[model samples]
Target: MMFRKIALTLLTATLGTSGAYAKKAPKFEQAHQLTSEQAALVQKSIGQEKILIKAIQQRTPLVETYIQDTRPDVKLYQIPVGDQYTLSRVDFGKGFFDKTYETKDSANKKGWFKGSLASITGITKALGLDKHFTYNPTGFMQMMFLDPTGFDQQHYVFSYVRREFLGSVRTWVFDVHPKVAGMGRFYGRIWIEDQDGNVVRFNGTYTGPKSEDDSRYYFHFDSWRMNVQPGIWLPVAIYVEESTRDGEKQVGLKAQTHFWGYSLKLPTRDSESVSMKVDDAEDKSEDSTDVSPLQASREWVLQAENNVIDRLEQAGLVAPLTPNGFETTVLDQIVTNLVVPNNIALSLPVHCRIMLTDTVEVTTVGNTILISKGLIDTMPRNEATIASVISMELAHIALGHHIDTRYAFNDRLMFPDESSFRRINMNHNDHDNQEAAAKAQQYLDASMYKDQLSTAGLYWSQLASRGGVLKALNTPKLGDSLLKTDGTPWMATIAHSAPKLNWDDLAQIPALPLGSWLKTDPWDDHVHQLNAKLYAPLNPRDKMPLEVTPVYFRLQRYDEAQSQAANAAAAKPNPGAAAPANPPAAGDPPAQPTGQPTGGTQPPAGTDQPVPSQAEGPQPQQTGGTPNPQQ
Candidate 1:
């Protein structure tokens, strides 16, 4: 919140400094020094805040939001950090609206406050992680802490804590507490830039105030603001970590809220680049680089893949790969174990990638398997359960099912990121889905670990049964299907002995969370599997599938690769990949995928076939497929 506003002259001086001037500038006090002068300066800031607040309110900038709720499993001595329970996670924003590409019940809806808020109480039925309280919602949590009026001197006591440099910005850290302690006031530390005297960052929680309307008010959280424009800092991210324990069973809530697209004219980053240039000169010459037919086919697949990935990264949807060898190795083992037993032939090298999201899904481009981290995080800790997930993508590769390759053309990349999803869809229809599912079952059956399918089958059954409450986790934002019937239960043909039916059972969950098995690169949102041993649940309650829990990351600024990918996905999806089309799950009948399957025991070796121009899904299609296991 904008509490204090510094003089424009001082701000200009601070921003205008060069190398020598910056070093020569006066250093701020490094220790607690709450003198009259400092208080007056803070008061002066408080007086000028109205102007900044008005500026922010008046501009209807496009704001994107992603909110997630998690549940964590704990050990005998360790705190809850075992299996994850992602209660709910929704991604949407205000400004530009494009339900065309959004999932059937995506968190991404229109308006600043129209969509459903992610609250602890709302998810209690799916997998109860809260024993004592609930939250207002994602949006409310963000706005309440950012209440400008709450920052006034009348509400909070501003005493100097210390002066520190967050990178090059010299800041005065103030310990802000309620002058009269009951409610409404924010309790935490605020980092104010010396030059602008503006509150650059606020880290703390709101006083419960304890009202009947909202039984439990707020949880401890950290909110960060970024200076997108000079002298103009706005809230960009928030992290929440809270816990409530009942004896040995402790329920934790880990979540993140992100805001961006703060502009009146919301154009995809790609659109801005497109508007600047128009080349009339057309050189129809083909590439001079020599390549074999099979290589060309593979390149075509990668071309479409690059185009999709480039756009997704720009939109903050696709997170890059973090440095972790274990995840990659696990994927290798799954593929090798499956292919070696099936005697599958392959010319193109198979690769695996990850989507930085909490939605359960598994997809493939060529032989590159793509899965969301959330899928692996919530699954049973075994190779068979994971193999069931990987087999679907493997089936897609073996069956020649994939997204459109037209994006390989340089001309196709001209479109904005908003149109990327619409133009380059990879979701399969109902027919192909069934085929993939059956084939995946066959692949698993032919594997060395066929006996392990029971766990995978149970995993599928649990996922299918919880169809109603786990809507957000089951739905995807873009591609990959997980179920046949949208609202109906989803059951794999490989089902055996599922846990006894209990509508309100908090124990024996089937899945985990995004961070349960993977560590995200806080800088770029990339992900990598953790280097830890996998252990089966000793207790049924230990299986806190898709529960929401607190998430903490070692955050750093975006790097070059992250920046470029974000730029591509930055465009909206008005003209992007196809929205939710077929069921997002595998094991359905052949829903018909792109690049028709070859007739024979195995797929044709690098056939130069015409891939689908576009994957057209049904209206109000489903997002998210089943969780995939890599290793």
Candidate 2:
């Protein structure tokens, strides 16, 4: 689906003479033999992978990929120098078939691609050339599955490493490599759940022919799936990273691809229709006063707002209205905090909703203010920075900057989801932005956040400084970007009084990495605050502002109701049945007590230790990571 125009010479320039830095592929001659019990589980997992593939094909899901091209930095290990982003609903049902041509003979150069490399290369060639080769953003999607065709022992060797726990699930970890080198196979480690034999997570890159430049075709990726249903595990996210050295200079890229909206369907009028009980249904128009001309105009504008919001929700771009959701509980409170203090009265109540994109943008849809998830994710986890962003859109609402009334007509939204950005126009022009920025300053001056404006300015300063490199992250799809096209931030005046940018100041955290504040439910698309612990940064590099990092979930099972129901069903005694005295056979996975992580709350076996970040990586922190204060 990506129409990237890559130059033919880019492969050599970016990767540097392919064979110059290529690492030798691993040999599997000394593979460990699995016991009967371990072999049975391995067999079960292979079958489960096939089932997972079939389940994915039956549903269309939203796929979002964000890439950060990084370069060496003295303070922060690596900072984003450039970026790319793509969001679309991919139909796995149609299937993506890409191949790798790894043979030495030019005529017979062909092998199935392990990742989406072939598709990316094909698209780049078809679209002609550009100065920098832009990869098909969806190329990383192929990392979700091991091998769609030959994933069995006939093609791969699985050596049991140890038993481990990823979140609450118990899994058997194994080292996997392809039996033959030229077939384009997955070379990685996989974690299979002990209970159902599902491959919950896999990490590594694809392998091609020995002589071919594998580095050009593949990058390391860690793909993880969530148990959405009782026995169904769907691919939720994949993190890709590659770091290589060319003498003293280091070059690499980091990307995160997320999938959601699996249950999305075509919009229908009937879906919006509400049926009420006859006794409870009543019209209050009879007791209300007739509408004044002013009221009538407001009503028309409100209609346009509702129509646009409803259409966006149906398209899965906007999260559904949940009563206790982030918008109602967190965002709405922030609006009230600003509105009441400034006495900004309007015809309708100003509310907020989250746009499910990671792009940093904000715009007003009539009285409703929409903020992108990326904007929220990268901000300092404090009220002032968040309030500063919200205040800008609130000013737009108060100033009567609204969406086009043409959207009031339901027929206007009949286009496909892919055409959403093209069809919907909600961005504010320069005049409106200038006026809103001035008005937003006034609102902040009168609000509780006035004193904290200095800290808020720091966040803006960081954003403005990095705006030049992080163009894709700053660009808006449906709203105005925080930064001007020329790399100057709209709120530059607000940040004019802030202190100079200092990397060594451990206490001064301008921003956090993406996904620092919110976590989206893959099934429902609802946004929630991450239940993370807070810790002070140990060094300046710990504050990875606006950079892409690896994804790690606390990893809880989905649908607790289903798990509870199954437990209840199992707890009931069979009629006239007695408990069996016989012990379980050898190699049987030991049963652990309920309500605890699998394997009795003990750490996983082997050298793999629990990561504090998402309980798997280095020390986890709510704000930007700082090194230990004691260090």
Candidate 3:
């Protein structure tokens, strides 16, 4: 056993060294020593003409057959315009798959068209096209040559790779790649017949970005085409298997072997035979053309300005008077401060009009910015909230957010349409960072607009109290549709039961600039019923306290004169009235009641007697008191 192990070790070491030595050896020497026939074969393989001819003879006719045998989820059609044809189809596999087809015609006319399954299905049902379901042979043949771009080159690149025998048919296999980004679905390999270059069988896999339906790949197409007519390739059947990484799969199969009986062709004339030679004539005619660079530059500038205005109008940022003045000012400041100084050429102005809405939304049309009303409404009644909104949008603009060169026209500048937009969700990145927060702090520290910041916070707090609908709309969560989703806050969740202070109590409190007038009232007509139900009862006792109205404070006052008669009446004494008798002193003992009167006046015993006054000056009345002397 030990001897065997040593022998095996030696063998392995020998093999490893030999493999390493071979890899280090020069590869160019072996290539240079190739036989003449082998070199000729290599040259023949890469030649463009041979490849083109093989592709045309093998793949061109199979195109129509492939369409005929396309999965039921995909519909193909031809649109004719002025003797030219445009082919387009809608893939119904995922949520409304949109695709356009373009082709070049023999008459040098370019044809391009788009149609969705919704449109085609309506047409088919309306015209009863489904009743005549038989395959149209002539239509299938014509579809192959309808190139929308007026060019004969195929949209897919094909390279002959190998030859293999499959189920009694010798096949020529080729590798195919899409030449354009939005071309039809791409697969890895295609197999054709070795005898006449007709595609016999094909097997390949397709991969692309994950779709909305969780599709990780576009479609995996495995199909077989046969030569039904001599040297004419046709698709016998096709199969497609779709899947995602999560083990979801949808398999489909389609077959189209028979052809329509009818065929039509346009009348032909022998124009080549009737052509005659004409004498060549040359005339010397020259005209001078003048071009002005200044005029061109002015025109270009005007066009750019017009485009900006149009975009602003569409985004609802520009009005007859406003004309996005705020946005323009912000952009100018940014350009002057950051972009121009840094030598960075801005494709779009660094300005955005952010709509204050419940949810956060940031989008741009040309140089105009559109923010949600909800975002603005939810902000604290202070400048910081405003700064927050502006800074968020400004970050987008400053970072060159809406700049795109993929689409030729500016009309297609949509952030959601961008490839990168799909990669990121609500997460904030370097582009939209904390610049707004920082700027707000800076302004607050500077004390330049302290009141505005406080007001902004109040505003935001009020908005937040109303709920985060504005924030939600502006920063929409997944599945929130613009047209259908109800992003409003629920009444049950809001803290609507505010403290009920009487009007008198409210009035008595020291007044601030805030709540001088009723800011919000439960009984207000504008208040929603749901909101009103949630509000606490308004107290009638709450009164608006009396403050010095400027007008009232400026009024004059007057005093009445004193009267002499009133003073005399007040000084006169009451002569007819008698004073109340005083109580007996505490120290004096009870005095014995005298039966007989003493000294000044006397009365008979046992008789209730009255005292008589002396002198005729004043007379006493029997009623109980003496009459006035004047009477």
Taken over the whole model, the C-alpha lDDT of each candidate is 0.51, 0.70, 0.28
List residue ranges in candidate 2 displaced over 4 A.
1-26, 97-133, 211-213, 246-248, 266-279, 417-421, 559-631
Tens digit of lDDT per residue, candidate 2, span 536-630?
78888788889899998655566663575357436633221211222111112223323222110111111122212213311111111212222
Q: List ranges where model 1 is wrong by over 4 Å.
A: 1-155, 158-175, 178-299, 322-327, 409-420, 486-491, 497-509, 531-542, 552-631
The lowest-lDDT stretch of 10 consecutive residues in candidate 3 is 548-557
Most accurate candidate by lDDT: 2
Write one digit per residue (lDDT tens) for candidate 1, span 500-564.
54424543445654357865443245554553544555555545556555433322223533464
Count of clashes, each model: 69, 7, 60
lDDT of 1 at 70: 31
Structural similarity to truth (TM-score) of each candidate: 0.54, 0.79, 0.23
Off by over 4 Å in 3: 1-369, 377-384, 395-431, 443-447, 461-474, 477-631
Q: Which pairs clash in model 2?
A: 99-113, 537-626, 538-626, 538-627, 611-615, 611-616, 611-617
